[model samples]
Target: MNSLFLISSAIIIFAIAYVTYGAWLSKQWGVDPSRETPAHTMNDGVDYVPASAPVLLGHHFASIAGAGPIVGPIVAAIFGWIPVMLWIIIGGIFFGGVQDYGSLFASIRHDGKSIGQIIEVNIGKTGKRLFAIFAWLTLLLVVAAFVNIVANTFVSVPQAATASTLFILLAVFFGFAVYRRGVPLAIGSIIGVALLFACIWAGMKFPLVLSKNTWIILLLGYIFVASVTPVWILLQPRDYLNSYLLYAMIAGAVLGLLMYRPEIQLAAFSGFNVGGKYMFPMLFVTVACGAISGFHSLVGSGTSSKQIDKESDAKLIGYGGMLVECVLAVIALITAAYIGGDKLKELLSNGGPINVFSDGVGTFMTRIGIPLEVGKPFTALAISAFALTSLDTATRLARFIFQEFFEDKTKEKQSILVTNRYLSTAITVGLGGLLAVVGWQKVWPLFGSANQLLAALALLALGAWLANVGRNYKMIILPMIFMFIVTLTALVQLIIANIKTNNFILVLFGVLLFVLALVLIKQSYKVLSGSERKGMKA
Candidate 1:
């Protein structure tokens, strides 16, 4: 609950990791990224893009800074601030940062081929296909889980959905103008962004809330069209601009904490670790991004790689972005600490994560010069910004997974690229749509396991990558092993819980994920069983 203590802890731990562990890991697993940039290089400022290091950093941070920082800590704090704070700082800077930086350097040094491609390239073709299959299934869950998150955020603020819709429209115009016309991208970007804000303001003033059925249709339309659109306009720019919103929100939170030094209020603070039923099993899984996430590595390799300007940029984009997320987590901790236990339960049960966040952040801002009425809505808008960022990115990733699944290695015919991409979008969007409609009352419990399932998959992939890097395999082996054990333990608990609740759907889902984990472990081990890198040199 002490905002300063949380922030200081994160920074101090990050410093420790940077000096002792991060440096040692770099020495061990680090590879020269310069040589590989030539192959998958992009000369155009869009796909094969170049930007200043900071802008690229912003892109990476914005892409990764979704609802995780806000929701994870808030949910996990049921265990107590001490426990939540411990893992977030230690696990975040050490375990999470290493995974993210390693994944970035690995992918960048491999010419921006995805983690799946890196797994295959370094391991074997069969290994690569297996990784892709696991990734596909993981992406499906990502679409289902995150789309529901975005939908809920939007459902709370029906007017904000209009802002998202307008943002998409402007992206279409910007995409067409730059790609199909003679307009410079810089000029187009400015105009498009201005128009997007205009629409957001209009939406707020009018407060449009379409019927649930019509609302779902409109949202689906945006998903399919936006997912299929070229990345230059929407995906890249939306993420780029949204970073400002996210950062502003975080900055506001930090500034508010500084100006208004609120004491911690939870009775659970410094309490005994009486977890399990309260916050025991749920702690690590719910607070994913601030500590460790399997998803960031995917984004690091997949989309962020396309925009990186230079070799050393990996440090900025990966490591720096993660630090920013940790700070956001600290702010979230302050919110949890500020809102005591009883009110916290009321907030949780009432179903308004954004409002709780807004109330906390708004309190901080209110102490400063900002008015409460304005600051609260602005805080809510920031939540919407992150939610939308996650929504679009999840859609794109799911599309990538779907496309990768049907990627037949034929010379002349491109099956997945052309027809299969649309099919993939449909499948991905439909699954997300289904979740938005039916995935009710499923919060930290289900989503936590799902997110960790991703972390497990990522670690499994990391272990494979690290093994091929030869001398540095030990750097990742421990974390990978730890996450593997944790996943196995959590999987067991998940199955038992499902049985008790008589939720056959979740039981089946958890079992399927468990099998995927086992398969990935077996496949990764098969490749890493004293095998040499079989990649064709570009």
Candidate 2:
């Protein structure tokens, strides 16, 4: 029940996974440093720009480490610390890290294309289209969910809104300074951080409050611009700046844990039933990005793959990033457990998960002599930063999927309008905004199912790719099957719940996802079988 014991356990396991399993997978994938990476080979300066390992690592980690890790564990702690810890460590090491690394590996090898495109190469065009559509929908939920979450935080948690608004403005300033004015990253970052801290200070002193609907509209507008802008202009720079904040938050959580060393107060096992849902699938679905997330694959292939400077960096960025997120999830779990069940339930009554996280973390900070007024807003700022990074990143990735969906079949020259960035972004943001507005309650469960399902499909695609190339694929295949089964079970449970409640919208969505997953699995089997037969013939 000691927090230090749990924290140390997670660190040791994650370290082993990275040094052993991650390294072995890298070798099996044949990550050759001598070979040109997509970023270098296709350096276009806009989307495909070669970046240093540190910079790209920042972007990759920030994109993947969304509210999922923080909120998922907090909510799932209802089941107890043991189950959440077990899944975050075990699933993170074996399943999440593998999926993320495989995704980045496959995408880099395929000229920075997404896992959906990788599926097409290995599983055929139909598989690709189905996967792409599913990915797009998953991302739509991502955008909607995160947008709503961020907007709510801004409305209810005034300091969060202040910090986030400053963060976005600081991001644009940093981007412009570095890219346009030829300012060095070190200097620009220094100024940005200084200004950021000032904003944080100002936020605490003069918080901005708005209505939830108003915040939602403002967030949607920001998403539209952020999505449409070139990568260098906003997305990359913003994530990079935000990454520093994220790292500081992570470090702060560790420091607080070390200083306070609170005991885990929640039950080790909170029984099979918590909050009206069975713990089996709900736990898995709830504790998603903390353990594993399909969305990481999209971020990996969608943006990070295009910016990676070398193939050697993929493992570090992809696998290491997930491990770091796992660490954050563990921290979140600790914070939530220490907060006690009654306190958390009370916090949830007023605000969303951000309140739970901020309240928990703020309590820890208070133990270290920081006032709740300061600690609470600071933690809220961290949560808002996390969610907003995901919002823009999701919107941008959705844009990519939208364009990929309409790619010219004949390989002929396509019109600019057909492949226009703004147009694609408009469609992506528009759809996500609409969903966020109406489907707020309906999206989370469906999102969790779809998100994890995407991880399974990505793994299947990676396994198929590895098989065709004649490599050891057991590492990929086993995890693929496990996630597929877990996600399918989650989807089924969701379907039954929706039916009982007569939530036909979710029911329809669940059924569609089930069918898509079935088809993808069938195609994967065919691809693997065909590859085996070809090998025998040869």
Candidate 3:
């Protein structure tokens, strides 16, 4: 098994899927170009700013991709490359892509509301409330896990810390110049990307060193600001600019693999049970964002839908963005495979998957005449940048879910806690920060199960909405069913494991999520069965 061969095959498969299956979905879902998107009709200059396809793709991809595709694949490669590769390709195209695209389309059609609100429209107010609580809690797990990831990355790779900080300040300037001052997009992008590279270079020259705890606190503060501020100011431009780093990193890795053609040293199959973990649900849960994630639904519906300039962009930004992540996941998997199982375990025990990924890509870049010192840090910085992207994006999404839960549909006004973005963001960030201090390793498994479960519920919502609107929702049905089984099984295992370990907090969360998912599933079943369509608006 050669790395180049595997990646090439995956790329071809993804391209074909995007053209044939992705196009079929668009046509089936009735993507009308003439219809005005929410971004235009509900333009608020903050959350509802319309963006061109490319810029929106950058933001959507950056937010959803984050370290998910990287972290999930590398960690799940414990089951060997074959299973991970298969899931990334199959799940990305059919499962993740469909959910992401459907969620975006559903939200846009419903006036750019979050998935919770979508549930309210197609299901009922009760279903929406339950889903909102589940979604918000899941977002907290996301924020905690990613914040821990970023903080640890900064402490281990201080140069990335410097680059990430510089990236934020530069994004603010880029957002102001391109969005507010009316600078041309092309010229501004050129300058921004060039400056981005300069920041990386400067980071290597002068690194920023900080304690892990201190970095965590600073990161919490940063996300609080990021969640409350206008999207254009930090989220959009930072993600847009940060996307180029990922693009370059992927391009570099692929080009190096093409040149080097490294052999897949890891075994094809590592048994169903390795180290007391069964492959049944653990493998699926572990390869989450790489295959399919519920988190992507939140991002697509929560933020990307609001910024979409048109409905047609949903396919490219949603479906296409997911495939792009599949490509990255393939790359991450190769990094682990090329190192062999033994070295991978050693690296995992030492610095975790991100370091393994950076080192592998750094070695690859050497084939293209780039120094390992530079290439490794560049890769590290890119991953850290995206992790930070996920951190703040999760915070914002969490804030959205929190605020939406309190919104009174029958009333004309809302409370300050709900209306005040600052207060809401602070509360969300504060809670997530508490979880972050618990460490990512403790939280990742629960997060993975919760994330995949969230995907299941999102699919349920999409299926219900599609059925309500009289469209053929056959595409969403199988994926929805499969995810429920996988995530439910994983959650049960997690609960048992946590109880044995006396980790009551995680056990409590696991039980809560399992119950919420079951309740949502029951409600969606009613809607799908035509027994609960009394107030359905779709």
Candidate 4:
């Protein structure tokens, strides 16, 4: 009956209500879920639609619910649990959920294109191109950050790296068997993952491969193939298969939280102290995806929309899936909180946030009759594999967004097909390869700022979309403004710190942020005060 546990549970419950109510309101305003959904009305069974709601949810959760939810929360817990927990609970439902659901609803109504496409229809022409380019740039950063995350696991933890390699190999085999061959996918995925867990067990007998640089190349190859292949074979199937690993992670965390009942270990506040430096920038950077992730919007509208079998499922997929990710963040916070004090610091210095999550998962596994050493590698591999999911998905989503940015000429002449899979693959591989050079050490600091800025953009887009639909729109505006201020402030602080430290790349990113902020502010001003929105409401 620790107060923290009670508080965490309460946060999750409130988030569900907030998102569900918003979705219901959207139904009232514009969307009629029953009246000929694009999923059912235009069900093509291949890309148009296929997965059941539960399965699709699993897929969405798997893809969006990656290292961000796990690692970010763990690191943010360094500021003590309150700040991290507060951000996740409140931000997920109100901020992240709105971004996801609004983007999905907007995409569906606009004929299942994408957020970038919706921006053109809803925002002005310039807004569309800016959104497209911004989306692509965001994806590049996502790939870079996630590549670093996976690479870190490889460099610092040998057993886990081996497991991650096996997971990728297994995903490939599983992809070919089920996706290419068209076997019973769900059952095949189950078997493949089962075998993978067993292989992970066997991997402890082999030598460890602990070269972060080597893994950077290895992961690049994985992403290249993963991006180029058909969604049925690689993206969908890989995500579908890997979701069970997520399930295992959840199950273990729940069991440990109950059995060990680890006390909430972090203080209510830690004076914003990070690395003995100012805490504001570090906290923001560390908590990127947990509190608010722009990446979720990409998942919401990209592949998830096409695969959604029913419009009613939007609440479940967009809202529910995001809330589930929030809970994962809470679990991460709990783990770090339980570890508490100096031990948390020791673990963080000795390894990284991945080690903290691994330690938590390994503890649970040990309780369930596995050795610590064995559980450690198993946890590591699972996480590394999770990182790959993020990399591939982000690359693909970014590519689609990039191509959409340059598609005006093609669309005007009716020559550009939206489903240009070949071009998209090129974008995916090119961006992924370009990012693989950056291992985690170089990229971790900016993850939060980028993620939050994206969240702010999504909110503005949603606010505009809501106003277009004729709702009060204030609900959307409040969150949008809040995220804009907090995140911009955080980014500014990070920039200042980078300048003092003589970090040129961070300075460049700071410039990028200012540009993005300028564009968004202008767009938002037009949405709020400009007469252009009067006649062009969607």
Per-model TM against the reference: 0.87, 0.95, 0.97, 0.87
TM-score of model 4 vs. true structure: 0.87
Number of backbone collisions per candidate: 2, 0, 1, 2
For each candidate in turn, give its C-alpha RMSD to the true structure in angstroms.
Answer: 3.6, 2.3, 1.6, 3.5
Whole-model lDDT values for every prediction: 0.69, 0.84, 0.89, 0.70
Candidate 3, poorest ten consecutive residues by summed lDDT: 529-538
Candidate 4 wrongly placed segments (more than 4 Å): 1-31, 35-49, 155-193, 205-214, 272-285, 409-424, 438-444, 501-505, 534-538
Which digits, one per residue and each the tens of the lDDT, describe model 4 over residues 1-538? 2534643584558565655776665655465656555666566644456566766776788888787887788866656677777777777777777777777766676666677676676676687777777677768777777777777766776666666666666766876786468777568866887887766765566646657777777777677666656565566666766777777877776665566566665787777666675556466556666756788877777778877766777777887777777777777777677778788888788777777878876876676777777666666676676777888788767756766765764455532434665666666666655765634345546666767777777777766766665655666777777777777887787788789999978788777876877786787677665455644455
lDDT over C-alpha atoms for residue 238 of model 2:
79
lDDT of 3 by residue, 20-116 (tens): 9999999988898788999999998878999988889999999988877887888787787899999998899889999999999999999999999
Model 3 CA deviation exceeding 4 Å by range: 438-444, 534-538
Top model by lDDT, which number? 3
Error of 4 at 525 (Å): 2.7
lDDT of 2 by residue, 330-367 (tens): 98888778767677678878875767777777777766
Deviation from native of the Cα of residue 352 in model 1, angstroms: 3.7
Error of 1 at 317 (Å): 1.2
Q: Which candidate number has the best TM-score?
A: 3
lDDT of 1 by residue, 436-530 (tens): 67753453255566566666666656666666555556656667777777666777888898899898877886787777677767767765566
Order candidates by lDDT, high to low: 3, 2, 4, 1
Lowest lDDT block of 10, candidate 1: 38-47
Task: Please give the distance, in angstroms, between residue 202's alpha carbon in candidate 1 and its true position after superposition.
Answer: 3.8
